[model samples]
Target: MAYKARLQEFSDTLDAEVIDLKKLRKLVFNGCPDSGYRSKCWKLLLSYLPRERKHWKTELEKQRNTYMQFIDEMIIKPGREATEHGGLADVTLDDHPLNPNPDSEWRAYFKDNEMLLQIDKDCRRLCPDFNFFQCASKHPCSRLCGKNSFETLRKRVEQTVLQSESVSRNRLGITNMSAVKRKSSSEFVPLPDGQEAHWEVCERILFVFAKLNTGLGYIQGMNEILGPIYYTFATDPDTECEEFAEADSFFCFTTLMSEIRDNFIKTLDDSQCGIGGLMDQLMSQLKEQDPTLWHKLQEQDLKPQFYAFRWLTLMLSQEFPLPDVIRIWDSLFSQEKCSTFLIKVACAMLLLLKDDLLRGDFPSNMKLVQNFPYSTFDVQKVLKKAVEISR
Candidate 1:
């Protein structure tokens, strides 16, 4: 069937609030270009979609409000000194820095200060190559907040603090890492709260996700995984869809992690189903299908963990271009067995460059594979080759 016809058929089912997964799977695997369709399709594939479509509005309201609540609680003013504590009227003598009580709200807030700093750093650096992640606001010209947003908060905190202590010193006295710093004297400067709306939104989702799943909590590279998902949703042509991207991305990401959580768990790395198992599986397939190349990679001591660990765990999101990464995900989620297909794509990636891989020594081969420019890569060609090997 033609593309529009296929979409029409899908739309009919969608209107009925019942998706035919088998059909949707075929569309996704082949490649979905319609951003609106992809936005919805992704939710379904990741199990973020309700079984009863009638409840979608309710489900969305529940999830989005939950995320907003997280933003309100987990994300707060770095109100410390009276100058900074402008917005936090709730901060009282009980919440002051000197409070040694473990249960003090300030104590708990200060406890994660270091981790928050790290997450802030990583989130800012996410997809730095892409301006979407590098800047705080995509369009700083129309932004409502920036350098002095905190100053406004300070006044609010000061008024609230006035009702209590004359002033409260910053707990941990830590600098706000989220502040936008000027990188150069160039006129084209990004604001401090720079596309902060987006980056900060991603941070809150990760924090909420950590609080929800204490076992895996927040991992270092999670921002990388979350980046593409949010970008895809936030950029959807439909304004309504883009507006709720954060809530949708969170639920989708949570479902995606459920399928692959073992990869992030330290205890499971050595297990057959963990990252080690995945690496072994990839090599095993290479050994069976392309023994010569498999042996060549192993001979150079270019272990799969060195490069493929990130590849598999991140669903190749970091390795491929953003657009290609989405296409790759289209294929990944469409399959009945996602892990099995992922190994095939990885194998196909290796096999496609068999000649370069065949001739190079250890360092040369490692650099070639690890830092290859996937931006210009032809993912369809790789998928074609991947499917051939899978059969």
Candidate 2:
């Protein structure tokens, strides 16, 4: 489809209105009716249409099952082959060996392919980019919360959080790994009052991730990557409460993930094809904008991929504040040509930092490169520059 048409279609389907978690919760859980556009778009995007409003549950199940089958057939089998050439299989796992069964037929498959099913399993559980659980009940539940029972609590909390009027405006701030670890250890051990609800939202987010990209599988750090979105989706009027509105926020998030899955998958591929392409483009642009700096970087053998991998993989999730990340994601998903937009944004960042980067020595340059989005760089301005460059 033409980009404009695609954007229009998507906008029409999504109604181009900002979704509120409270309204979504009521629509999703309270048996509140959906507008025709919402119902139509939901079915169109999910590729499942129910004959009656009452049949949504059955339809959802069928959609989930169909999605799983598609992954098993189209993504997993093909991915296994594509990854066999020391591709995705080479990544080591800390937990367990790949395909422990020696005599099983899967072993033969693994030996020939040089693939690790265990890593695949880990990807299914951890990667926020791939949605592997759409067809199966493979998510880990807290042993403390009984199986699937937490879902009920989650729904209730979502409703309460969305409807309450006294919710705090304080955003969850980002702290360094050390600080987070110390705070986590010192925090009260008792499950927060809405712990189940929080986890429930996480579960749903995982489910959506699995459904969206079976090839990427689940990975660790995804929960952290998705934390702000979960909190935003569940934020309610009550200061202490968290709630989920219908599947609206979830689906909206699903759309955003769909837009960014390629960048996420690039992290897993040792080939770094996407990152390499971006690096090539960045180098070309750098040469044009600042030949001296570009030549210096080349002289030092400092490839863009060395430092920019995290920027591409996590969409700057680790480097930027959650609100800024969310803004970037919003622009990415809202725009029809997000992939190109992302490339341009990356270029803009490099260009904006060129002066500082050129002044630093190799080791210092590496450190400064690691600390991107430096004090002088404005993310929004960079984004605008990217959009223009992309155009």
Candidate 3:
């Protein structure tokens, strides 16, 4: 009965004409109700949606239509041109595949394919324990299948000859190489040519993001960050919201990325906001909260880079199951100082396993932190402990 009452309170809070974010955050910090509250709470928390309910429809339409325009300009037209021309020789005399010119469209397309391939590989393996990503979305992108549409990122990748090259590395320094080969459409088994899977939608979003943001063109773990946001919006109960899930997810993911992009940029790794600085903050917090454990870890030389790099960089998405990650994100997004609070949570995670770290050697501790024991501890407890640490 108390749970139902709290859920009702959350519903009432969200339904307010202009939401009080302070109040909303306090309610949402506990965790969103499973009955589709996250879809709205996340949008608001991420600032993708305005506080005022009256502006929602207009804002959504403008953004969704703009996203479709991006698709038409970036993906569909380029794809159609590539299809119509058949080859570089036919398309233009000046800019061929081998053109060394920086402005060459063909070069840009090939480069995008390289990034897209990496995004595809990471997205395909997303939450492998569940078939949610592999399963066909009930509301596949209709614009891509319309009379004017030419091809999607999935189709283009299968048909195009992607050059074999080393794309980029993750936080842990593992290099990813892409060697895409031409394959037939018939090879796409689970879904037919017109239909789309969840991961394909994610791939298109990341591809467009990479193209628009050339400076930080798609990183390896970006797909992991995007997966949960897309999944939350994609599974919304409201058909109208789910129909535009791709657009909604794209905007929300973009907003979230703006805040965390520094961590992914190589040049900024040691800067105040970069991953290195973040890990330093984590270690400092550990040293303050549990001096003995902090000294022990330092003596063993178990740097936060080995484990917390993935934990902090990926926002703990890779460490825990999808559901638990989402639950953790509920508290994270609600916090005013999300990143500062994240350090506190990291400290709490270590303090929770203080005994194990003290008893075990470096290898065991590395394995334990890398593969967090999510099953052993309640996520609620982790959040509560994080709160206590903050206090």
lDDT of 2 by residue, 253-333 (tens): 465556555555635344435545555656677687668878888988887766666666566666566556655654453
Please report, as a residue range, the 10-residue window in candidate 1 with the lowest summed lDDT.
Answer: 157-166
Model 1 earns a TM-score of 0.80
Q: Which stretches of candidate 2 lie over 4 Å from their true place?
A: 1-184, 188-194, 197-200, 207-215, 236-273
Measured by TM-score, the strongest candidate is 3
RMSD of each: 8.6, 14.4, 4.1
lDDT, candidate 1, at 126: 68
Predicted structure 2, TM vs. truth = 0.50
Question: What ranges in model 1 sit over 4 Å off?
Answer: 76-92, 134-197, 373-377
Tell me the tens digit of each residue's lDDT in model 3 across 303-366. 8888888788888887778998999999989986568778887889999999999999989998
TM-score of each: 0.80, 0.50, 0.89
Encode model 1's per-residue lDDT on 153-234: one tens digit a residue.
2122223211111232211111223334434333223245334446666765686687677767776777778988998888
